[model samples]
Each structure stands twice: as structure tokens, then as C-alpha cells.
Target: MTTRHLVDPELVALLDLIPATAPSAENLGQIRAMSPRPPVNLAQSSTLSVSERFIPGPAGAPDVRVLFYRPISAQGPLPALLWIHGGGYIMGSADAEDSLVTSMVSAIGCAAVSVDYRLAPETPYPGPVEDCYAALKWLSTHGDELGIDSKRIAVGGSSAGGGLAAALALLARDRGEVSLLFQLLMAPMIDDRTSTLAEPHPYTGEFIWTRQANRFGWTSLLGQEPGGPDVSPYAAAARAENLEGLPATFINVGSIDLFVDEDVEYARRLMRAGVPVELHVYPGAYHGFRMVASAQVTETSARDQLAALKRAFDRSV
Candidate 1:
């Protein structure tokens, strides 16, 4: 049952670098403490200007913090990306993705907003997603001020962040507040039920992110057992009954990633619902394979993502 033999040879070394420890209430504090933070020299980027702001949060909630990245020399009215960071929805901050957002803004000459939404096990369900919505609303409403084009905005993220991005897309469509150009989901963790499946994928969930970790993360976010009948689509995008009218989508996942089946199924459903979709499944890969920055697969995935974002922006224009 070991999937170690199935992993891309180039990514095998990364297994030792990234521990497979599952998060539990007892060790969650230590995990959060060990999470990477934005570099002190984040503002040193010559091509991009990085700044932080406290924006209005969900009604009755504390203010949401966000990091904004903009190409210093870009022309007016650029496309923007509202990025959510991963960490199983329990850990991770906007600051952790400063470099990733900066690279995108620099490459695409677009504005980027990395949202610092409230984490779960404390905020729970609607709170975390609502914070993202508030950030999206703020970005869309203040587009002119941010030198971004509201019409060309996109939402994206990795892992739990991708799950939120998917949920946010559904929320935006149903609420009729914002029009998203596209959604970039990189190995999105969208199905709480994946952790509860009667027969799990033996090849997937054996690496960086396992079913045990997934269940812990989902339980933390829901404040209850995951895969329950009452799960909300807004909480778990895969629970959504309708994928109609969602924005064009770009989804990419490792063939052996824990969420591969769910991600692929979501893409198929989107296509069936008439949403334009582009999906990629890289072989011999597992969840978070992008952490192996030097690997060819990582490079390919990053290139594909950048190209898709650029294309989405171009079409918007």
C-alpha cells in the first residue's frame, strides 16, 4: 500500500524536507509557530511594490488584514488576483505567500491581493470564507483606487486556499456581487467527504497531506465532524449541487494527490455545467509537489499556471 514508489523521482527528496505529521489540537500551536512568515526585506523587490492594509471584515467581525502587490512600473488598470494561502485552513498567513504573489504580479504585470482571512477552529465555517468574500468585495469595489480592473479580477489558491477559492467563486455567482474572470485551483482541498470515503484511494493521501490531516483540518473548520449531511457548499465546494454559471476555471492537481479524484470530478462537473474548464493531472506526483521547486514537474505546473492566468487576463481585455 505504500505509494513511495509512485512518486516522481525528483520529488522523493522533498519527503524528508516536509514532514508528514498530521495536525492535532495538541500540536497545532507548534505547527502555527513554525509556519513561515514574510521576509523582513519583502519591500526590497525592485519590480513590485508590497504593502499591507487592514480592510473592513465581515459584518460584526474584526478587520481583515491583506497584503497588496503591484508592479511598480505597470500601466493603469491592471488585472488582479485575490490569492488565498494554504495550510489546511488552520495555519498560514497572507505574509507567507508574499513571494508567490510578488512573482505573479511581476510576471503578469497585474495587481495582487493576498488575503489574511481568519483561521478555523476559532473562526469556523462561514467566518473564514466570509472574510475572503469581504476581501474580494473590497478589492472589486476599490479596484479603481488600487489601479486594478474590476472586470479582470480572478481568485486562486493552493490546498485549503484553493478550496476557499472554489467556494468563493460559488458565493460570488450566487450573491451577484462580483464577476470573476477565472479560478486557479492548484490541488484544491474541496471535498470534506474525501476523508470519510468508504474506500479511499490507496495511492493518494499517503504523502504530505493524508486523510488524517484532512479530517483534522475539516473538523477544525466545521467545528464538527466532516462529511455530515448538513455540510454547506460554501464550506466544502464539492458539496455544491450546481456548478452552473461559475467563472471559467483552471484546475491542476498531482495525479496521486489526495484531492485528485475530487478535483477532477469538480472539473468534469464544471464542464458539464457549461463552464469553460482546463484541467491537468501530472503523473508520479503527490500533494504539494510544488514544494520541490527544482523538479521538472514543479516547473511545468508553475509555467502552466502563469500561462493560464495571463491568458485569462488577456481574454478579459
Candidate 2:
């Protein structure tokens, strides 16, 4: 059964433009090579300044590279966001999301540090997430220099980046080193079990990021078959038993996305654990639908995200 008819009329054309290609060792290099890397143009925005720097990574690991975005004319200690990029844990670079971070920094009047974490199949689980932690610690410790409010930091990302954000939030809570104000998870890929479900969602996982791609991504990141018994919660956040004491969360996913069920369940669990959560499910949409920038759903999603961030930043917590 095809879900093509259910797709938003404006987003239908995007399906043809982005063919579903599962990543594997054989074609990973080619796919990555073809992935778009939009240049970070500071000239386009007079109010935002962007700089790249290398911060110390996890113990014994290499230095993690990060991109910092700040409002040029803003004063005082501003709230901060640690932005992560999405590419199913296998690919994607912080530089690729320059426009995204820049937009948020410009609109929210906040500082943002985009972490270029090491990717998987090569670095894997703790490596990628630990790199994010390094960035967060750097951001928190250098508040005086970065002009950021250490107590008001938030973590966010799209897809795999969102997964890392969730994991990082949990890690921050457990480690007691840095605190988070909010977590913005946009269709986060947080469950390895999704790929191994005996009976998968019939209408979802049919476009953009499909079940096959999910399986490949999970396998690469885990360095083992997904759905196995010993997957760590840090690697796949849904594996975590407890969701308490974490910061407030905002999660949004397309109804037809491969991750809708997992994301919704995570939100429900977060609420049950006494954490504040905001969840939105967009209808007639598939994974990565936001790539269709002109689509109404994409516009709505962006607005919702920005509004949620504003509220989080404005709150006293």
C-alpha cells in the first residue's frame, strides 16, 4: 500500500527529487559526497557573526570542531543552544547547517554552538555523543568569554542530531556537570528497535528515510546488528529506563515519518516522568519533509520550533 496520496500536495514533488537510498559500506562514500554542504555566508546577515573553533574532545580523543553563532550587537549573557545536525548518525557536518543555526541565532537573539561531532561506523556511540558533551562543557565553562548564560543552555538537533541531543540531555543530567533548559527534538532517531519491528507501520517509512535506511544507520552506529539485547541508551535513547530529572522537551515529527511512534512515545514517557513536554505530529508528511522549504507544513514546523525556543529561553528555569 502506497502512502503517496496522503502526502501534502505541495510536498509531493520532493519525493521524486530525493530518492530513498539506504546507506551501506559500498555506497556510503558516494552518498556523502553528494550530500549538500551549503556554504556558511555571514555576509547575508549583518546582525549575526559566525566563527569556527576546535574544543577539547572526550578524554583521549581528538579535538572536536564547533561553529559558534552570535548576535553581533547583543549584550550581556545570552541564552545558548547546542545545535546538532542530522544525517542518520552516519553523515552530516555542522558546517552543513550554518544557515539553520544562523537563522535561529538571528531570530531568537541567542548564542548557538553547532558541534561537528565525529560520525559513526567510524567513531560510533560514545564518540559522537561525547564530542557533543565536550562542546557543551566548553560552552558552559566559557560563558564569560562567549557571553552566554551558562544556566540557560538548551540542546537541540534534527533526526540523528536530535537523538544525540536527547542522549546529551540524559548524560548532562546524570553527569551533573552542566544543566539544560530544554531539548528540541525534531523527528529524532532514538530507537534502534524501530528497524527490527516485526510488523512495521504500514503508512510510514516509505519515503525519504525508510526502514532500510534506519536499519543500516543503526547497524553502523552500534557496530552490530540493531535490536540486539545490549544496545546502550546513550547510543539509542529509547533504550533508557528512566527519563526523570531531565530538562523540558519539545518534540515534533511527521505522521508518516519513520520515527513518529518512537518520538511520540518518548514524549509521553517524559511527561509521565514529570518532565514538561510539547509534542506535535504533522499530518500527511514524511521524514525530512522540511526540505521542501516552500511547503506550508515546513513553514509551520519552523514557526512552532522558534516559538517553543523563545518560550524556553524566556522562562526563569
At residue 220, give the lDDT of candidate 1.
96
Q: List lDDT for all candidates, in order.
A: 0.92, 0.92
In model 1, what is the error at residue 218, expressed in angstroms? 0.4
As a TM-score, model 2 comes out at: 0.98
Q: Positional deviation of 194 in candidate 1, in angstroms?
A: 0.2
The root-mean-square deviation over C-alpha atoms between each candidate and the true structure, in angstroms, is 1.1, 1.2
User: Which residue segments of model 2 deviate by more than 4 Å?
Assistant: 36-39, 42-45
Q: Which residue pairs show collisions in model 2?
A: none
TM-scores for all candidates: the values are 0.98, 0.98
Best by lDDT: 2
